[model samples]
Structures are given as structure tokens and as C-alpha cells.
Target: MPFSHAFHPATDHTRLGKLFYDAVEPASFPAHILRYRNNRAAATVGMDTLTDEEWIDHFGRFTPLPGSLPHPLALRYHGHQFRQYNPDLGDGRGFLFAQLRDDKGRLLDLGTKGSGRTPWSRGGDGRLTLKGGVREILAASMLEALGVETSRALSLIETGENLERHDEPSPTRSAVLVRLSHSHIRIGTFQRLAANAETDAIGQLVAYVLETYYPQLGVPAEGEAALTLFKAVCQNVARVGAQWMAAGFVHGVLNTDNIAITGESFDYGPWRFLPRFDQNFTAAYFDQTGLYSYGRQPGALLWNLARLAECLLEFCSHEALTGALSDFPELYETALDAAWCRRLGVMQENPEADRAFRHAVTLFMETSGIPFHCLPFDWYGGGISAQRALASDRAHFYNDPSFSDARKALEARRPLPGLSLDHPYFAGGVPCNMLITTVEDLWTSLNDRNDWQALDRKLAEIDLMADALGTRESLSD
Candidate 1:
């Protein structure tokens, strides 16, 4: 069925008071419908709250609210699907309610997913499941609290309809996710228009993104201009991975459609944080190949960025885009190292420190053999951050076997995580964190520690300790 009004911009009238008669409708799902109005969170944005009845009036039955207006314009975008170009993709079942400036001057767009069908539905059902909305809310909130930059969930309302979901139990309830984001332009958006030979549209979207999210890029011609945008993207990609690594998060799916051009974590789906270290861990139960394993996050991100670079082929010379792509490795490596340092609370950046950091990572993974979640993984990955890092990966000042050349490199720093290691808030158990277990396991077969994977686990322990110690220091300071 065609939509009643396609891409109609409406300033959620329920924003001020109850959405009286004919404003909302029952959720459109087959499962349990759960309605979560935008009152409480909306208040934070300095918006008014509506009564329960008003909420129902606005969302329960499909009707325009009092203050609602056709959006001044249809949100414009294009992107790739999988690896294919898709030029005609827009809000198939969603619309931008309004654009507002947050306290920090960040342009925040309030968007509704599953409100109804739009010009972009592409002849498919445009519905959202309650469970899916719940998942995204938890994913975004948890990641943000872990210090990852992410989109925020403003509200999730049940439209009083039962939804059929493919991944969950049959006949799930329906819900709507009204999310706030810095930008929604995605890599797929670029690929879609580019594939249609709509260079002009791609340019318009690129310019919009620059003016909206990365005004600093200034939308110059390809070459250094393209490189600048690419560089910005690479930095964001690297930094996002660093944050993910620090917290042991694994994004189950990282398709071109999922990677946000703005660099903020967007489109939360099947995400998990490791409780124990395991390079082969994944979030999706069906990811049998582990194509997006926990350890391969950095590589996957780089690949996604490369796809984005490919989209810019028309605006910039192939050489320019390639040059920008090249920066990804150097930039990602540095950010990776820096993230380890920050997570460990290391005070300096050096190859030696990074090596020890890698070793620490290796140790934790080999010993625990645990999935991405477990008690030990939670503490350090959570905030057991010690502000101190090793002076260098070469800490063997004393000729002690326990403090061997490798151990020396790892433990050469003084003040140890300096002080955070001693704090209770950051401490989980006295010992046996995933990283510690890995190191101790290595100790049992000390010689076997030479194995790359085994050593990686041990290094993970060192890094975890550093994080704990660093966290303890912050409390002390």
C-alpha cells in the first residue's frame, strides 16, 4: 500500500502537550506493542512533555499533531547496499521530525524510524520491531557511557501494532525509534547516487555533510581537498575503533550501509562487548565465519573507509583518493596505539609501549578462551583504567626471570598505573581478570609463552592492569 503522506515533515506536535484526537495510532506489529513516549528525555532537550493520553493521541493513532508541519523539505540522501550502488534510497518508512541545535551547538536531527512509508520504501514493508528498538537503545547508551561517540536514542514508542520479526520469536510487537544524530548521511548514500551517474547529487550531499558535520573540510575540489575529507574520515574511523577496542566491543555487522560518513557510531545493530579476550569472537550468533571478528575491527573499518574513498572517484583524482586511503594505515596504527595508551592510561606514545600493549592483548586472548563477555573482560574493558603505561616495552632493568626481557619491557614504569590499580571502584576481583588469567596460564608453560597467541593474552593482562591502575589513579587524583 502506498503511504498516506510521503516524506512529510512534522514537528512532533506531542512535543508541547498531548497529541489530541487523530494524531497517533496503534503500533503496527504482530508482537507485543510497547509505547515509550519521548517525554522524559525530551525534557532534557528543553522540550515540553505530553500527558499519557496526549502521547497516545499523537503516536497510538496515525494523525497529525497540532503543531506538526510538513517538513520544510524531504531529507535527501543516497548510498550503497552491500557493494552495489543505490541511487534511489531515502526515508522509506521514516521522516525527520525537526532539526534543533543542542546545547553544544551541534545540529541534532530528530528522526522517526518506522513512522510510516516514504518515497524510498522500494516496495518493501517499512516496519520496526520493539525488540530492535530496545536493542539499539541499550547499545547506544552503553557505548556512549563507555566514552564512545554515538547517536542518542531520544524516544522509543510502541505504536500499538504487532510486528513480525525475522531474528526473534515469531509475532513480535511493534515500536518506533526516534533517534537523535549528528548526521545520517552514510557511505551507501554516496554509492547510491554515484552509481546512478548522479554526480551532481553526490556533490550536493557531500557539501551538505561538510556544512553540517565537518564544516572544517570546506568542500574543496578533489585532490588535497578530497584528501582532507578522507583524512577526517580516516581519523574518525581509527578513533572509533580505538574506542571499540578499549571497551572490547564488536559490531556484528559493518556493511557499507552501516558506516556513517560523519564518523560517529550509527545504526546500532547486534553489538557486544567482550568480557574475556578472544580474537575470534563475534556478536551475531549466525556469523559462523567470524568475518567480523573482534580482533579484525580495525581492518574492517579501514575497508569500509576505502569504499567511501572509492565513491569520491569523480570529485578527486584516483591518485588523490588513493593517497588519502594510504593515510589510513599510518593514521589507524597511531590511533590504535594511542587508544591502547589511553585505555591503559599510559602517559607516553612509543613503539616499545605499543609492542608491550600488543603482547598484553595477545596474552588475554589465549588464556581466557572466553567469549567477548565475562567478568574480567568487563572491569578493564569497562573502566579499570590505570593512568600509567610502561616507560617503554623494554623494562628489564633487573636480571630476574619473572622480569625477563619481555616482562621488563612491560613493567618498566613507576607509580604503576600510578594509582588507579588500588582503587576499589575500578577493581573487579583481586585477580583472575581475563588478561591476568592469560598471563598466569602462560606462566604455567613459561616457554610456551613464545607462541604469538599465548603471548597476546599475557600482554592483554599487562594492559588490563595498566587500565585498572590508571583508573585507580584518577580516583586518587
Candidate 2:
């Protein structure tokens, strides 16, 4: 295969040594049927030219990428699952398959889901239901289009296996998913080292993360390096949490393992986009207490970051680490305000004005019982689209007396410079949404009749939405 000039392979993770992960083999599948390929993501790493056969071989068969990891590595880590510390947690059914640099020379990892069993499998079948894979693809696509910092679902291939899952009907189809992410090193990675009292390993991991992910910070004094990295990670994670809030997403699981040190959202299990503004809404059926609910995500993330800080305590003082953690609320508030402005396509004013606007928008949405997507879709350009929005079918909801504050807020802000409202996506009757019902229907069409039209059409609509939102352009920057 001809790898493009932009394709730069690196085995940087290996530098962390065997103590952080274990070499593993991918399971040999009965069949390799390609389901989805993220050509855009592939293009970033210069693999978009691969034929279907080659794509299947590399992603499904787990063939090593040229100049990348020769074999898979099931990473070692421990995480707090729903506030309960679980020492046995790790990559139970996934592995870091390959690592390479994108066009901008940033490291990226090709990680697998349901590729095989490993020491962490714990007697469970190391397989992903086809329905689960479909959900993840949709989740990633929708989140990315909405300008959320998330992993890209690189490739999904049916693996011709019958799997029994409690969550779904028996004898369901199986698949393997490959996701492209900035990094797979999780807070749990550091937790594992801390748990074992491997202070030296923790220091090594801290140095590796700084050099690989935060090189801009440069070499800090030995005492300040860990604190510096913690602060950066805090900022990144806070931005992610704020983005989720702006997108009205509920990540059902906020486990330490799922919270990547890089702050990129990945491992979409039981995720949901809000149909309406409901703070108590949760995606996972198992979340009885709503620990990671839509309204509480910011707090949940801060809690997880504290866990990461605990691991870094060996290198930094408690007061310094706590102060770094203290920055999360302000950082999240700032990011959330900016994210809302971006989504609304309005120019941001002072912090007080921005905060008031956001609060007004939230108050109206919660009290009016309007669909979550409708508000942003209707008022995308703020006051600039007021006439268009009021003329639409959803205008009745906007006319309510409760909308007065939000209306005033919108009228006070100007549309972002060069933000055109003429995009066909805005003119459409309905906005692109990923409600649970829509997802289930899409899956049903594919599973019962092998009809991919609905799924394909939805993806195309999502792309149009992205174009209108300028999320694709923002991501490129």
C-alpha cells in the first residue's frame, strides 16, 4: 500500500514500558464484512485510499499498519466505576492496535472494540453487539457534527458471530469497531500506578504525557511538571464537559477509565442526545441514581479529575493540586458560555452578558418544554433569524411569555461575523437530531431488512448540519 506523506507512524506508547500494558493477539473472526469507514478521519492519517479489501484486512483482521505497532496491546488501568473503585477494570475487550501521526504531526491511536478477549475479559465474551456498534457510530458522528471534542469511529466491520447479550435479544450479530483518538491513556492509567505504589512509574507516565501531549509547556522543574500536566488536563476535561452541556448530551458513563487524559470523548456506551432540556435525563438504564446525568456532568468530571489529582499527589503538594482542581468550575463556566455562543452563532459579549444569556436560554428551555434541538435550530443566528424563526411552525413555542427573557438576550447579541443564515440546513423543516427512537428505528431497518438507506440519509443530513454549524471548519483549525 502507498502511504501518503502525511502518514507518520510512531511507537511512542511503547516508551511507557511493559508495566503499563500487555501484548495481546486479536481474535480471528469468521468473516470480515465492512460496515462503515470514516474516510475523512482516514484521510487525516493518510489511509483514505485503501480499498475495501485492504480496509477490512487492516481494521477487521487486525493486520498491523506499516511502521506501527506489530501487535495489539491491552492497556492496564483501574478506574472508579460510578463512584465505586474497581481494581479489575482495564481494556477488557479492546486494545491499542496502532499509533500514527496526523497531517499536523499529532499522535493518534487506532483502538479496537470487541476485537478479542484479554486478561481483563474476566470470563465474559469479548464481543460487541452489532446494535452497540451502530449506536457508537451514530453517537460519534452526531457529537462531532455538533462541535463536541470526540473520537472518530474509523471503521466498523461485521465479524460473523452470534453473540448473547443481556441488553439485547439473544443470538444477535457481532461487530468490531476501530476508533481514532488523540490518546488512550486514561486517568485510570495513572490510578493503576498509584494503586501499586509505583511512584517512579507514575513520574515516567507524567513525563511521557507532558512530552507527547503538552510539549508546548516545555520542560518544567521536576517539582512543577506533574502540577503543570494536571492543570492542562483539567482545562481539557473541563472544555469537554462544557461542550457536552452545550450539545445537550448525556454520557451515561463517566467512569475514570472512560475519561481520557487527553480529554477527548470516546467509548460511547449508552449515550443519548436530549430530546428536551431535562437535567435529570440519563442515557444508561443502570444509572439509577443519575450520577452522570445531563445537569451533573460538570460535577462528575470534576470529581474524576480529583481522582487523577490523587494519583499525582506523589509529585505535587495537596494544596497545589487542590488549587489546580479548583480552576475547573470557572474553566467549565467559561467554556460553556463560549460553546453556547458558538452554537447560537452569536458574537460573545462580556462574561456577565454571556452568562445571563445562557441562563435565560436555559430557563426558557426548561420551563417551556420545547425540544432541545429546536431552540438552537430556530435561533441559530440569534436576532438575525428572529423573523424566520417566528414564521416557522415552532413559532408558537417561542411566543410564550416565558420566552421574553431569552428573546431579549438574543436581541442584545449580534450574529457572528460572516455567519450566513442562508444555509439549506437551516431552511429545512426539522433539524438533524439523534433521539433514542430515531437511533432504534435506524438500527431496526438495517438489522431486520438490511436497509441502509435510512442510516445513509441520516449521515448525509448530519454532514449538512456540520457544514451549516461550521464545526468541520472549526475542527480543522
Best by lDDT: 2
- Tell me the TM-score of model 2: 0.99
lDDT of 2 by residue, 113-176 (tens): 9999999998978899888888999999999999999999999999999998888798999999
Indicate the worst ten consecutive residues by lDDT in candidate 2.
1-10
Per-residue CA lDDT of model 1 for 296-399, tens digit only, reads: 88777888888888778887788877777777777767766665555443444477667566565445444635343332222242222222112212212222
Per-model clash counts, in order, read 76, 0
- Name the runs in model 2 displaced over 4 angstroms: none
**What's the C-alpha lDDT at position 245 in model 2?**
89
TM-score of each: 0.69, 0.99
Q: How many clashes would you count in candidate 2?
A: 0
Model 2, residue 9: distance off in Å is 1.2
